[model samples]
Target chain A: MIRRLSQARERGIPEATVARLPLYLRALNGMAERGLATVSSEDLAVAAGVNSAKLRKDLSHLGSYGTRGVGYDVEYLIYQISRELGLTQDWAVAIVGVGNLGRALANYGGFVSRGFRVAALLDADPEVVGDHIAGLSVEHIDELEAVIRRRGVSIVVLATPAAAAQQVADRVIAAGVTSILNFAPVVLAVPEGVDIRKVDLSIELQILAFHEQRKTDRMTGGPAMAEEWPEAVDL
Target chain B: MIRRLSQARERGIPEATVARLPLYLRALNGMAERGLATVSSEDLAVAAGVNSAKLRKDLSHLGSYGTRGVGYDVEYLIYQISRELGLTQDWAVAIVGVGNLGRALANYGGFVSRGFRVAALLDADPEVVGDHIAGLSVEHIDELEAVIRRRGVSIVVLATPAAAAQQVADRVIAAGVTSILNFAPVVLAVPEGVDIRKVDLSIELQILAFHEQRKTDRMTGGPAMAEEWPEAVDL
Candidate 1:
C-alpha cells in the first residue's frame, strides 16, 4: 500500500491559484492569437480581468516569475502553464446524462479541445441513449460502468437530474472515476478522495441577482426596507 | 450626476467570499428543505464542503455570527443570505446565441425559479432566429438593443462562439447590460464598472486533468519523466 498519496493539496499550489491558472493561460493564448510575442503583466492582467500584482503572484506559483523588464513570452508561458495544468496530454471525458443540458454539453464545440476529448455520452432515457451527438453514440445508463472502463475515462461529467445526480455520482465513484464535473442543481455527497466541481445555472443567476439587487438598493436607498418580504420567504 | 456605484468591491465582500456565499446558501437551502431548524458551523461546513473555521470566517463577513453552541437558525440564515445574494428579487435574463448550449440553457429547468426569469433568447443566425425555445421566441441579434430595453434584461448570458464573444459583449455592454455570464472559451474585454463571470467547460476539464495527472504521477513513480516535450507553441 502507498504510504501517502501526493494530491493537489500536497502540490503546494493553492486551490485558488489552480483555478486562476486557466484564466491566465487563456489570456496568454489570446495574446498569442493576436500575434503578440510578449505580454506585460499589466496588459495580461487587464486581459484576464485581474490586477498586475495578483497576476505576478499567481505566475510565481508556476515557478516562473518571468524576466522583469522583458515581460513574458506568450508561447513559453502557455507551455509551462499547460504543463502545470496537465493540458499538454490528452484526457478522455465521459459525459453522463443526455437531457437538454447534457446534450448541450455534448454538442458544445468548446468541450473538446486542447487535450480534452468527449470519449462517450451516456443517458438514462431510452430515446436519448440511441441518439448520436457530437460524433459520439449516446450509450445507455446501464452501460455506465462499461463505458467508463472501456473508454478509459478518468473524469465523469454528471448532468443528470437532481434526484438522479447522487445515484449517478455514487455509481461513477464506485467505478473508480475520481474527478467529476457536476451540472445537476443538487449537492452530491462523494467520498473523501473524490473531487467534484459543480456548475449550476440558477446558482450563477442568484449571484448576479444579488449584485443587481445591490445596485437597485443603492439607487433606491438601501434595498427598500419598507417593502414587505416575499411570502415565499417566511421572515 | 449619479452617486456612488454599489459594486461588489465597494461592499468589502471579497470576490472570493461572494462566490462562496452562493455555495453556503445552496447548502443552507438544502438543509432547510430537509427540515433542519438549526445547524452548527461544523455541520454547515461539512454540508458546504469547506472547513468549519473557513466557514466561520466567511459567515462572519456577512455580520452573522450564528449563536455559539446553540447553532444557527436555518430559516433566518437562509433569509439573510438570500437577501444578501439578491435572491429576494427577480432578475430578467436574456441569452444571446441560440446554439446548442444556448438552447440547453434556455430549456434548463433549474433556471427559471429562484427569482430568475428567462426574459428572451437572441441569435445571429437567421435560421435560428425564428425558433422558439423554453417558451421564449428566439429573436434576431440585431434587435439586441431593442430586446434589452423592452424586456428589462439586467443580465446577458453569452453562449456565442469564441470569435463572436468579444463583439457581442461590446454590443450588450453598449445596450446597458452591466452584468454578464460568459460561457465562450475566450477572454472578453469589458469596460470599467461592468461585471463579467465566465463558465468554461474545457477549462474545468483542464483543471481536473491536472489533478488526475497528479494521481497518475503518484502511482507510477512520477509521470514517465522521459517523454519528449511537445513542440514549441508558436505565437
Candidate 2:
C-alpha cells in the first residue's frame, strides 16, 4: 500500500494529499448531515483538525476551489471528494479471520456507511466456521478462493494470528485479491504490485510511549542515560 | 500527535525516522529470539521491509553505527531502540469503551508483549458496566478520572461511539492524560500539548478504494469523469 500511495504522486496529487482527501470527505459528510449547504475553508479546516492554508492547498489538488464569499458547497464537495476517493462505487471486502477483532470489524458501523460491504468471513477452526456473526455465516477457510471468486471480493482484511497471517495473505493474493488490510503484528512480504496496509496495535502504543517519555523528560531534567551508557557522553 | 512527532525533529531524529524505529526494534527482537547475535543492515532492512541505506540512516540518528564487519549487536540494538522509543518503562493504558473493538483491544496479546498494560476497561452501559472482560471488570464511565489517577494511566484509548468520543476525550484530558488513540469516526479537537492518534478502519478502505479505482481506470482507457463534470475540462 505504501508503494501504491507513493504512485499517487505521479497522478498529479501528492501521497499526503491522497491521505487528507479521506479526512476532507469525512468532514464534508458530517456537514451534509447537519444540513450545512456551504462551508468556508477555515470552518472546514477547523472541523478536520487541520490549518486553513493546508486545507486549501489539498483541495486545490482535486481542482476544487471554493467561492470566495460562499465557500465550498458541502454536498458538491462531498460528491467530488467521494468520487476522487472512489467511494462512489460499491466495493466488496472479505474478512479472513473470525477472531475478536474480526467480529468487531464485521459489526463496525463505519464500513457500511461508506461504499464497503463485508461480503464474506472465513476461519480455519471448524467450530467457528458454521457460526453466525453480524448476519453472515462464518465460512470455512477452505472456501476462501471460492468465496472471493463468487462475490468478486477485491480486498481482504486479515485479522489472523501472526503465525497464520503470511499464509493467509499468500492464499488471498493467489485468489486474485490485490489489496490487503492487515491487523496482525508481523511484517508481510508480498509481490511488487500487491498492496498491504498493516495496523499493528503495539506500534501505536509504542509511538504514544515515545511522546509520553519526552513529556516526562521535560518535567525532570532529561532522560537518565548515564546509568545505561556511562562511557558514551556524545549520544 | 502530529505536533509532538514534529517536535522529535528538534531532538535530532526526523519524524519519519522516529516512526520507523518501532519497525527496526521489532525486526531486531525477532533476530534475538532466533539466537542471532549480530545482523547486517541489509538483513535487518529486509526483515523490516525498508531499504538498507534508509535503515542505516535511521539507526545512525540513535548514534548506533553497525560495525563494518561484525554488523550490529542484536540485543544491544534492541536495548537502544527500546530506550529511544521509551518502551523500557511500562505505560498504563485505560480503554474507555467496552464495545467489541474495546474487548478485542483488551484481549490483544500484542499490548502486554511490549510496554503497555490494559489497566482498566470502562463503559457507560449498565448491562456491560459490571461484566468482566479480559479478566478486568468493566467499570462505569463515571470512574474514568478515578481510574486514571488510581492506575497511573498516562494513555487513553477511546473506542466509544462517535457521539460520545469528544465528551470522553474532554474527561480524559481533564484527568491529566496527554496521549490518546481514538478509534471513533469523528475528528477530535484537543488543546495544545495533548497528542491524538486516530485509527479509522473505513479510512484505510477508502485509501485502498482510491488506488483500486486507479488500477481499474488504467485497465480501461481513463476515468469516466465526463458524465459527472461535463462543463469542467481542465480537471
The TM-score values for the models, in the order shown, are 0.83, 0.89
- Give the runs in model 1 whose Cα sits over 4 Å from its true position: A1-11, A31-43, A53-57, A63-69, A221-235, B1-17, B36-42, B52-70, B221-235
Query: Which candidate wins on DockQ?
Result: 1
lDDT accuracy of residue B110 in candidate 1: 71
What is the C-alpha lDDT profile of model 1 across A1-235, one tens digit per residue?
Answer: 2223245324578777888888898888878989999889999898887889998888777765477788988998899898888888777789989888888888777687688788889988887877988888899989987776666777899988888999998888887778999998777887777888887777677667767676767786543231322112111
Could you tell me the TM-score of candidate 2? Answer: 0.89
Predicted model with the maximum lDDT: 2
Considering the true interface contacts (CA pairs under 8 Å between chains A and B), give the fraction that model 2 also has.
0.38
lDDT for predicted candidate 2 compared with the true structure: 0.82
